[model samples]
Target: MLFARRADWKATKPDNLHEPVTSTKGVKVHYTGTRFEPFLEVHALCAMRVKEIQREHMEGKGDSEIDYNLLVCRHGVVFEGRGWREQNAANGNRELNRAHHAVCAPTGSGGYTDVPEKMVRGIQDAIAYLRRHGAGWEIAGHRDGYATQCPGDLLYGHVLNGSLDPGVLWDGGNHIVRGGETLGRISVRYNVPSDYIILANPDDLDASGKVKDGMKLWIPARGVPLKGADPTPGDDATEFQPFPGAKWFHEEPSSPIITAMGERLVAEGCSEYAKGPGPQWSEADRASYAKWQRKLGYAGAKADGWPGETSWEQLRVPYVGQKPGDFEEFPGDAWFHDQPKSRIITAMGKRLVEEGCGHYSKGPGPQWTEADRHSYAVWQRKLGFNGSKADGWPGEYSWDRLQVPEDDD
Candidate 1:
């Protein structure tokens, strides 16, 4: 493989940097987010782009050094972006970044999609390099980490389908994505988070958060256990708080997640239960969740309504509304407090329609009208969360019943 070390690129000194990453789940696929010219010569243009990313991280973003451990140029050449001895800034948040080494795509990885074959190969080379070292087999995209769209779509599509995987990741397993699937949805299938799916199959999603249908992805056999409820998040809590994922299913019971799942199932016209879609993954909830699963071409065990990450995501259940985790840290703030008009409100409106909760003769939109609030209030009351929780604000408990992606809002 054609490899260019950092020395080959003549990189500049960085202002600051943290300790070298000690261990990690694996590599993360990233794009420059800027459109660079593709080149046949490989070294020159790709090297310049690598240096440019370093400058952006250090000079523009005011970081210690280049955030990535390595980069792949258009001609399938692996150029060292941060070589080693630096923690990546692009992975997830602080603690999360420690679990990953960053790999960036050269010129063709961003903006205008359709990552070149050569660039894809270069990314593979970078992963292979990381693998040769101590990097784990997991490979996730930027969107899988935080809420940004850095890698772009085309390349992310390749990741979903497996053009970026090759022999790098362990055969943890493969998941063939069905229709209406996202990384979040796919993760739900395996009872894991979208981030786990990304790390297990880094090539599957682009930074913009677009996923490909019928894409066969890698599922990590093991990793971080899903987080349960947090008592105090930002204050004196010693435990770092991560947003709930399929962990909602495996870990301790999250009433909000359970409620959100039930609400979303009802909206999707999958509820068979005469009564409760209550919290705590019940038999009724499974039956309803399974109904929606069958609609996705899942059958038998696949459609058994246990709420896998893929189906949960496909269900578009908003897991944030009534969960213990506060929305103050995420988007859709006013959403949990007031039924204000916003993207999250719009999503809630749509979820309400799916649950047959729409009062409007027309439909829901971005603006939250009295009708929307009332409709949500009605759903809340039906779910047994009456009183202030059912004031139509769709608190953590109510939002969990809806199961909508926090960022999806």
Candidate 2:
């Protein structure tokens, strides 16, 4: 991992800043908003993006320094910003500022088109590194908890798709109702068919395709790629189902379950996604699942998402952020104590952070060292553990206290 430190990017030191905040939630993915040229070289293009974003955050946004905690360049290099253990000004509100770290990816000259594969990997790597340390697992977009579209549509789809981790708010349909807003108008706004909006909220629409002045709706994402074209579909069940799924792309967020599956796959080290394991099942999921199946000694028809009961039973795992599951081996302190750094250790660290028991100099590193033990010990002490129980290793008693949720549903 080629990590560019603060000096490497020529970032200005934060001045006049007081009482730095720590994020207890997860991370937020931000985009440059404005378009830039496609990256030809990592050093030149990435550095320019870092400089410009920092300048805008400090000068225009009126912050002490850059808003984000890091920037993932298009060539898969992670540029440090406020670094870990500091507050991010880019996360919408003051409370959210204290809850989440911010990371930015550049979408370049055409605004939210296909971002480079290297850049997407870099973003995921940065998130993994943060998860290894002490960041929470709730990955979100800039506009997820805020109003403005700072991360754009295409990139935000990945955020919804669980690119970083779990707790992604499903996208392409959250909109506020305003005065004179009709089902047709809302459909136009989100680029979805009016029929989708009607299906998302049947009771809210009027007979003439009108809408109440103050009725909120989950407008499914734009189905009709053809702008100004008739979205009129025959009254059929297939027409009501959101995206045209005669074909599926790995790049779009379509549903909640797909996002959950993607998150689990990412934590399991199957990152074949460029955009999402978001709302929709894409080529990424198939490719990732195929790798997993390949690892599991499966061949031919026993690959990808089409799995039998035996495959499902064998591929069990504990969700990092979502609801916990019945794993044959629950990753506990033994998995972390003196054990090598891995995804299990990272998940445990994220849970530790959520419990407000992190105490590492830099981060909850992937390495199963003294830091992770001490952090868990802190939480154990909070649970009134003493003597052997407070030895900084996770025990069932303390693990239960942490209440790691299982994504059973």
Candidate 3:
């Protein structure tokens, strides 16, 4: 939480070129985007880099000062940019700039994609500093409302999961219930255990365990190191079934995975199936999942029955030998028909054989052929697809459902 003044970086005096902004919605995190060299961890080098960025902003974009409100270096030092006195120009457009204060990390692709713990703490400190200076409670990545991936994948993951939040004290506190806020949502926001919160606030809950608006509830802090109970214990490393894309559901795919997911939904009291929660995707599965989303406080387009990453993670569907993020992304429809020869095809062919749909009499070779097509058609049929939908060419949805291992795997 060390602060360096604009004078510390030898920054130019305020030109009043940037507009005045006393308050903002929250803070948006950004990264260097380009490669950030490792040698720049030195304090002098970090200051030099900040000065370089300021010069780039002044000369290239014709800005009055650095576009960011604050800049955090890898060594956990917070450098003053535009600071709290002025609106930042880094959040894409004028409207966005007015809404959020921008905070840049000196981490990016190539050179420093994985941020260190100290750097994470530095960014957390930056957010805390912003909140103290009239910024609101929201915290988002730069790519949230914009087009480009300014914060990159690693940091954006932290932003989504609340890892970058300057968490409240874990000792204990009274929290006034906000409108539309549930115990589940509150636990996520505070990084506390829901069970612990419920145990602490028995007086505030209704007969069915729902909290009313404006109810004052006790929030027990995590990491108390008590003898008998640990509020947040280490999670067992269990494998989770990766979400086979939404298209897989509409195609009526039949697999053990489907039955597992249905069983989980049933356990959660969200089952809508009239008969068997069987090894097949049906309209019932969609309806049941919609109920699950509703229970989670989602509505409108968000509760459309299709699985999103956030909802899927919350489902905690037991793994069938694959982790959530380990699956390969779709390589595009053109990759299959381009006469390509690669191990990815071989892996896919092997999976098809394993699924008992291999139509080839010879080898499941790396190249695409009629046998491969016929074999894939069998797979499509196995998944309950038909006619034009079972055309044998790999669609992104079916490909994802197939869970074809990457060449590296």
Could you tell which candidate, 2 or 3, scores higher by TM-score? 3
Question: In model 2, what lDDT does residue 154 have?
Answer: 77
Clashes found in each candidate (C-alpha, N, C closer than 3 A): 46, 14, 1
User: Per-residue lDDT tens digits of candidate 1, residues 258-312?
Assistant: 6555655664557777764555666777678779999888998888666676766
Model 1: per-residue Cα lDDT at residue 263 = 54
Q: How well is each residue in 1-409 modelled by candidate 2, as lDDT tens digits?
A: 3467788666778876644654357788888776553222323335545766777677767888888888887666678888776787778778877778888886643633566666775676577556655778788888876897778877888877765442222235467778777676665565444544655555666436667666677654321112222212111100111221223333344544355455445545566888535555667777876777777788887775554445544544212221223322446444555578665565667677877888777766557878888887888777665665487766543554455434312
RMSD of candidate 3 to true structure, Å: 23.9
Off by over 4 Å in 3: 169-409
Query: Highest lDDT: which candidate?
Result: 3
Every candidate's CA RMSD: 23.2, 23.5, 23.9
lDDT of 1 at 120: 75
Clashes, model 2? 14
Q: Which ten residues in a row have the lowest lDDT in candidate 2?
A: 233-242
lDDT for 248 in candidate 1 is: 62
